[model samples]
Target: MEISFVRIDDRLIHGQVATIWTKTSKCNRIMACSDEVAKDDLRKTLLLQVAPPEIKAYVLTIDKAIDAYKNPKYDSFKTLFLFTNPKDVVRMVKAGVPIKSVNVGGMCYKEGKIQITSAVSVSEEDIDAFKTLNEKGIELELRQVASENKVSLMSRLDSLKLI
Candidate 1:
């Protein structure tokens, strides 16, 4: 499977992802890898339902996603992988997935999490996971939309002295 794009988006699949990023990725498939979402039948169905016309979509657990990636049957698939957190991205990478870079997007603010941007927030765990990904040489870019300029996530954290 060719991972056309990998994005860490807490929303998983939404208007911006279904419309903009999918188009920008030029992928024929969109796979959301999250254990939480995969176990929720309603959310999985809803996410797949919102997929762009002519594009296939699936919500799978990280393990399943990794297995699918290693499967030769999906060799022709050009996929956009979406995750809700950086830890999951790190998990996939550690599982032998050749994820060269990751687009950090739409991590909503929650209590105990520092707001990094209007659309992004991070907790101590998130900061560590992001640092790990960066240490492993994965490009972490922050962009909420396709038309916006890409900002280095690590740099933003450094500038704020959060890391």
Candidate 2:
């Protein structure tokens, strides 16, 4: 399977994704891997509906996504993986999904989370997961759109911690 892009955006299939990132990634399929989102039928339908017409999209559990990635039938798939949180991405990586990099996108501020970038915020668990990804040599970049320059998420986190 060719991983065209991997993004962590809380709003899994929003306007920016359906209109911008999908085209930028050049992926034929988009898999939103999140156990919580997978269980919500309404949310799944909404996400699937927003996907661009030419590209297929699936809201799947992390395990199901791993299975699909390993399945020979999907070997020709050029996939763009989407996640709502760093923990889910960590799960996919631990399950042997060969993700080389992750784009940290719009992670909106919520209670108990510290703002990392204007568009991103991190909880303690998120920080730990990000650190793990960094330690594993995976590139973690922050970019709201395809046109913007990529910023190192770890560097931003480190600078924030120092402040």
**Model 1 reaches what TM-score against the true structure?**
0.98
lDDT of each: 0.94, 0.93
Off by over 4 Å in 2: none
lDDT of 2 by residue, 1-163 (tens): 8999999999999899999998898999999999999999999999999999999999999999999999999988899999999999999899998899999998989999998788998899999999989888999999999999999999898888722
Q: What's the lDDT of the predicted structure labeled candidate 1?
A: 0.94
- Every model's Cα RMSD, please? 0.7, 1.1
162 Cα displacement, candidate 2 (Å): 6.3
Clashing residue pairs in all predictions, respectively, total 0, 0
**What does candidate 1's lDDT look like per residue over 51-73, in tens digits?**
89889999999999999999999
**Superposed Cα deviation of residue 90, candidate 2 (Å):** 0.6
